[model samples]
Target: MSDFWLDLGFRANPYAVRALAPTADGRRLLVGRDDELAALTKRVRNSDLHPVLEGQNGVGKTSLVAVAAYVMSQDFKEGRSQQLFLPLGEPLQMKDDGSELIRDVYFAIAQAFIAHHDDLRAAGRRVPRVDDLETWLNAPTYRSSKGGGVSTPLGGGYATTGTGLNTGSAFTDSGFQTMLRRALQEAFPGNSGGFVGTLDNLELLDTSSSARRVLEEIRDPVLQLPGLRWVLCGARGIARSLANTPRLNGVLADPVDLLPVERRYIESLIDARVHVFSVDESGRANTPVNADGFGYIYDVSNENLRDTFGYAQDFALDHDPAFFLDSSPAEIENSLMAWVDNLAEKSARDVRLQGRMWRLLEDLATAGGTAAPGDHDAYGFNDRTHMRKNVVELERFDLAISSRDEVDGRRRSISLTSKGWLVHFAKKRDLLGQGALDLSMTNESPEV
Candidate 1:
């Protein structure tokens, strides 16, 4: 079927499903994390010192960590590592209470262990199967009661051995702590084997005492197992605070704080996208009519495509584009903010266009690049209808599409146009030019 007349509403959006393909991390869309990946692998395999992947949001810390873990698991068959993903964004109530926080941390870790039990068992590890671990992790202090609140276990911490063993009994703080330590030892196998853990989002347990205690206990020299290593991925704020606590001093003292994915690497990402868009899975470029030279290639919101493309490419090429540019943070921010302002204006003008454009920007800001279509809406952006309209308008801009897909069933996808890129530049230029452009031009459509 011709690309033009395909019913898009029924067809899935390629740009929407787009993700940077997974790397060694089991994800198809992992772009630009070589150094971070190497460093994390080393820390996980060689050191007792807990390594944390620290960075701002959208910096690809989690993706890097996940990739490392996936690599470790594959490379070392004997040394099976399980990822205990803790997405603690919402800080628990009582930010500073240590004991309560510790309890929460224990539960969180225990849950991770439980979730990946089958994987652990298949690897010849001696850790108690997930079921037993779950039982041990659930504390005696909190029981689901008929009322909403948890009920405390009676004669907690000890089993009633005078008769049948009390299955309902809960573990005390000390007991829970002991169970956790055992679990760690079992999985890690002190001095015997290697285990890598990638724990993400430590910022959520803010004041929870339980969380801090987990770090302390895990990092304790006494609990040191030769093969057991931890790599934490979280915000700089979490790492900073973790550094302050004496308990976490050793664990977080040495961390790899990630910056934005190097621009060159980002460019590599774009290049890859260009390749995929222009060619098929086998790598042959798509053939078409004589116009435009090559097959279809989009330049959505052309403002920053080249620049963003350049930044990613330069980073990938040199590994340290910043060293060459000598640009300051303020300069980078100035450039970025200009791009943002342009996006804002674009979004405001074309109701349909604005939604998809802003949604893409948010995805870039939050999750690095455009996520799979379903995931975009999940991240709090426009729905499919908005996306469809934007694609039609953008394609129409380049004469790629002759008419609108007002009908419910139409196969359409969005690719930025050269003109769209100009629009992006115009918006950013407008943003950068305070008194340069007339503010009175605001109400008018962006017809250049």
Candidate 2:
């Protein structure tokens, strides 16, 4: 197919499915996050505790952190702030294996050193010795079998266990860990703050106890490092469980809960990106999804910015260019809504959920798309077993998903899948058309 974005006067697709990078252009494209940016900047700069960003999946937590770090670097560059904090290119994915996590993180740090070498030099920061890092990183014998102790590039046979590194060094922390700290010290000099790095996707661990265990494992090796300020991002209840963990006390700050961007700002958000990615800065650009249409999709996606963007792009591309180029804004919105309606109908057929399963889906949507398994009672479910049977049916159809946490002795966490939300919203719109819906009786459609 021909490129539709160019026909719309954009240099690129504004709704591309990627988080905003920590760059000048990315900052401009980021909108409606000023308050969040400011609060995050403060937490990064002044607080000793690592800031945790807690939100639903794809609510732009990564974007918020990246932009905040970029802005801080700008402030420092312009002499408005006292320190420079280089943002790593991407958040480190929290790992289950201790050695692997340490090795991978140090490699990332080594790369950051080279990537920001110029900035460090300009700021009178000492760029750490790259030769050593390069040699070690490129060494043939970086590791051995999982059970064996870690091997060194120098071939000194360095190994690490729960206790610490065992080699020539008597240090509890490994030589690799020591090297990482020293590199950070060289980059920032004295008390200039440090690299603003993020450890993301704690929820992928699936259970709160595992999350806590992994975090505690890295506490001394990574989190306690002096020259790295951390922002931890998580979805589900991982942040909540970590917040309550006694082992992480004084280490992690109370999470900054990130709610979805209000639909009121949709236009501004689109306009900002449209201008940024336009073929000409002053030229008119076509954004096919009107605010109402985009808002509807955004709501149905449970305010997941990533999925919402994906849907918008897919919808735009699924149709011909003339559909957008020849249509009025109102006409375009109607078509988009119809497209989503067709999707919902297809999902309804695909799931083919029974009445009880549908009832459970509705309760989940009503619970803001996430609730405890115990919440089944409130949804008129007879008991956990009855709820489980229905939820399993929903899961089997890919309509609902659940997670368990070691916290509170296995908290039953369940959430509606994207399809489930679409199914729920489909029912909602139908009821609204019939004038039978009671809650969220606003003239505007509600976020289910």
lDDT of 2 by residue, 147-243 (tens): 4454433233334322233322322234556555766876776669678888988887788877888889888878887778889998765787787
Cα-based lDDT at residue 342, candidate 2: 80
Q: Model 1, range 208-309, lDDT digits (tens) per residue? A: 243465557545432243334555665424454455576665555465667665444544553344344442454233111111111111123222323333
TM-score per model over all chains = 0.47, 0.86
Error of 1 at 147 (Å): 24
Among the numbered candidates, top TM-score falls to 2
**Angstrom error at residue 77, model 1:** 1.8
Off by over 4 Å in 2: 131-174, 409-412, 429-448
